[model samples]
Target: MIYFDNGSTSFPKAPGVGEAMANLLATSAFNINRGGYAGAYRVADMVLDTRELVCQLLDWDDPKNVAFSGNITQSLNMLLKGYLKKGDHVVVSSLEHNAVMRPLNQLAELGVSFDAARAEVDGRLPIERVEALIRPETKMVVLTHASNVCGTVLPIEEAAALCRARGLHFVIDAAQTAGVLPLSMKKLGASAIAFTGHKGLLGPQGIGGMLISDDFAKELEPLISGGTGSVSDTEFMPAFLPDRFESGTMNLPGVAGLNAALQYVLKTGTAAIYEAEMALSGRFLAGARALPGVRIVGVDGLEGRVSTVSLDFTPAGLDNAAVAFRLDSEHGVMTRCGMHCAPRAHKTLGTFPQGTVRFAFGHTNTAEEVDICLAALTGMIKGS
Candidate 1:
């Protein structure tokens, strides 16, 4: 299948992702820091290497500050639930995924007030609009780096700076932009970043992480309290940076795969990947806009965006699920068709009540695939 659903989880991951996971499961099955033997210590060393690689990727000075988690959803939950007290205020955006919105929504019932920055009807969240929503009581500013459904990249650096200048903690969800975009934790002024390794990172599922700043690392409480490999002597979670946040036996095999996947991106170069995907999406966007029944979402340009682009064909009386089925069956093109778990974003973009068809591009997608998808879509529109 010609997969264009990388915005959800990158399919057919980088060359070494699966191999690395299999190799680790077969050769290095020992628990980290559990035994003094070489087997256990070797596993621990690999995990440390993964942490250091992540630090280098994000330009973080401290590898100890990065914490491995299950996914962005879990990391967001841990941060939102752990850090926010009963009365803390948060600043969110209308462009947020449910991963951020759900927790904050639940917290609303518990006396946590929030202000959501509105997005333009085209899905862009202006920096000034977001800045205006920051109240005096806002302790945390949470936002997505890019729209998972529409590929509109927000000004994360500006949002993070707004939080920093106001002394509010900044949290970013980099589910769609981690490997496809140039982002530095320091440069972006983010206190903590939740990432999904399965997406742009091209890693396996069940393994995602967060790169936390030293300041936030020290202050953030452990949301999931359990047995960390370190400090087993006490019931209290260790007061260390990563150890405090990480609990239970870690996803060592998944981390190993993630390290390999990240290595692939580093070698292939992020700029090259971004350029390729942007070109692909640009071709699709320009072509779709020329079609009669096709309507594109997001800004007219691909600036400040990843490779994802959403389109609306409901105006032609086509059901999203039927269109998805036709594309997968008649054409070999694969795409995600739904609200994409960001109903609030759809509401902001004026696509709510009726979700749009999303076409997310990956590094492996080719010009031929784009041509084929456009041809199939054009035919569908005419036939409908």
Candidate 2:
């Protein structure tokens, strides 16, 4: 089976990911910072190491600024809820995922408003477009590093610089680009970045985090206040970097898997992985474009995109869902169809109401797999 739905969740997670989780689950049953025992200390060390590993991957200086959460959704919620107050304004891109839209939408009831800078048809957002949306009350600028629906890389650095110049905080949702792209807080000039482990990071689900700059971390409040295993004497939640945000028991097993996966990603290097996936994506795009009735979405080339490629088959009078079903059932090629949780993105791409079928490549996918998928798409079109 060819797995092409890496955008949803990566398949065949890094070699030791599962083993790492299983090892932690089987041998350790200790809660971090709960007690002064060998097992607890060991678990605490693992958690710290995982945070440091994530920091290293993102080129962050302080691991303590990395706060673990259940997923990027939770991280975004924490950031949005903590940072934004009523009567505050922010700017977002047209290609933002629902994760960003939903939370901000909920905040709108309380007076937070945001404007979406129109993204280019090719899925790139220009800094000028974003800057034009800024208002007097604009407190921040949030953008997706890459579009999950169309795989277009946004202008993160340029937009971040705009935010900095305007005295607004810049937050990036690196859901699609985290492990696949070389991310640096200094390079991107981002005040904060939210990431998930299951996708490009090649780790298990239920574990992800947000990396906030020192100053930004200080201003943000914890979404949930509980026993942070620190400052136990007082009922008040600890006001430290991570302890301030991490209020509940940590997901130790997930952190173990993330630790192992981070090691794998660092050792393998994102540059090599990105090169390979782009090669596959370019191959698939080249072959698919040759087939009649296949409409390639987003950028035509790999210059400003990741490995994901969305195809619209309606030109051939085929339903995107039906096409995806056949690709999985008959062609043994798995893919995700419909809006991919980014309805606004689909609308921006002119594939709204009826979304396109997405084929997202991963680190383990190859050119041969791309050929097979291209051939399968041809068969589907011809048979129709």
* Candidate 2 lDDT, 137-241, residue by residue in tens: 999999999999989999888887788888899999999999999889878768889999999999999999999888887788878889988889999878788
Worst 10 residues of 1 by lDDT: 291-300
* Among all candidates shown, the one with the greatest lDDT: 2
Model 2, position 267: C-alpha lDDT score = 93
Provide the overall lDDT of each model, using Cα atoms, as 2-decimal numbers: 0.86, 0.91
Predicted structure 1: clash tally: 0
- What local lDDT does model 1 show for residue 290? 78
Misplaced by over 4 Å in model 1 are none
Best by TM-score: 2
